[model samples]
Target: MGHVIVGVDEGPEAPTLIAVAAEMAQRHGAPLSAVTVGRDGAEQDGAPWLPDLLLRIREKHPQLQCAGFTLTGTPADEITEAASGARLLVIGSRGLSGISGIVRGSVSQAILEGTSSPVLVVPSRTTSDKHRASG
Candidate 1:
């Protein structure tokens, strides 16, 4: 009922994940917090991109509340920490998990296992090639 958090990396932005997440957030009337994980040197030019992304999301859904957080930490740690009071957490399956996810480790799986919040692992149904082709 509160907000849905989407974890992402700096490069390789996934449109499917963002589109799906934005849709869900709009549907549920919940705030979409797009969290991009980074290491120590994350702050750049006073975090210009964060405000830009926020502007886009806010424009798309005037009724929806949205924000972005550029976190300086491991993906799992940053995302898990942010998911503390979230109603739901959304992330791409290929993020840190692949086919052998049930056994091996992934940031999504780790956060899923560790956090009490529900995590929605949106599969990379649309491949990179397809995205590039379409774009």
Candidate 2:
């Protein structure tokens, strides 16, 4: 069975992306793979967090099969390659404004363009939402 693959980063939205992916995997009875990519020679904050994230997912869904991968390469390219033939690819959107998103470029957009797998993008919580959640 094709697995559900999730692109993970050490961003505030990572948990949301992971949770959505896990739920999809559970519903489909597919294994879950969490992947974080770093540029060659550059340190990635997400690299160190991948294992812990997988552990938490496993604990939360004890019957789910979960795996994590830390890779070095371009984020879009690596994620696309990893998601090849996957049942689904889950990613997070930072919810940047259109112009800002164009200026910054979006890994989710690039992956969407490059990969054949279906993608689910979880939107990031806005600043006010964060504050409200904390409040």
Candidate 3:
């Protein structure tokens, strides 16, 4: 079975993204690969954190196979390349909209345009959103 590829970063949406991707992987009986991209073509601050993140995921979902790595390049390009032939590619949306989303240039949007693989874009969540979900 093709593996599930998840684009990860040190963002507030990361946990949600990883959880969704891991669940998808488990459902598909596929391995999960978490990929992080460094925009400047160098290891980013989150490079060292990827493995630990994967470890936590593995701990939570013991039967799920998980691995993580860092890549240096444009986030969209690198993530799309990594996701080639993947069963699914999962990413978290920054929830940028309107002028801000246009100016910032969304990697998820670019990936949608660039890849044929199925993509899942998880929306960002806020503390208030969490409270509402739990309460």
Candidate 4:
């Protein structure tokens, strides 16, 4: 079965996207793959975080079959390549506004345009949202 792939980044919305992807993978009985893209040798420190992030996600979702990958390239290109043959692709919305916001950020827009698989864009969670929900 094709995996459910999620594009992961250092942004605040990454965990939300990962959770959605993991849930989708569990529902579909497919493995979940998290892909993080950065320039070569530019972010080696960030590579170790993917596994830890996956482990944390697994704690909440024990049944999720999850793996993480770090790649060097354009975020959109790497994400598109990573989701090849996937059942679905999950990404976090960067909350870009104005006319350009019609497509969100460049990476999200590029992935939407280039990926063959279905894409799910999860909105970034904000402190205001938490307060609104609790209030």
* Top TM-score hit: 3
From the highest TM-score down, the ranking of the candidates is 3, 2, 4, 1
Clash pairs of candidate 4?
A: none
Candidates in order have lDDT scores of 0.73, 0.88, 0.87, 0.84
Consecutive 10-residue window with the lowest summed lDDT within model 3: 41-50
Better of 2 and 3 by TM-score: 3
Identify the runs in model 2 with alpha carbons over 4 angstroms from their true place: 43-46, 127-135
Clashing pairs in model 1, backbone N/Cα/C closer than 3 A: none
Model 4 per-residue lDDT tens digits across residues 1-135 = 699999988767776778788889988989999999888568565566678779988998898789988889889999999898999999976656677776545678889999999999886778448657999
Let me know the TM-score candidate 3 reaches against the reference structure.
0.87
Please count the clashing residue pairs in each candidate, in the order shown.
0, 0, 0, 0
TM-scores for all predictions: 0.73, 0.87, 0.87, 0.82
- In model 2, where is the ten-residue run with the lowest total lDDT? 122-131
lDDT of 1: 0.73
User: lDDT by residue for model 1 over 13-119, one digit each (tens)?
Assistant: 55555656777889887888888776766664434556666676777778877877777777788888898888778888663335666556677677787787888
Query: RMSD to the native, candidate 4?
Result: 3.6
> Which residue ranges in model 1 land beyond 4 Å of their true spot?
11-13, 41-53, 95-105, 126-135
**What is the C-alpha lDDT profile of model 3 across 86-117, one tens digit per residue?**
99999887767799999999888999999989
TM-score-best of 1 and 2: 2
Pairwise TM-score winner, candidates 3 and 4:
3
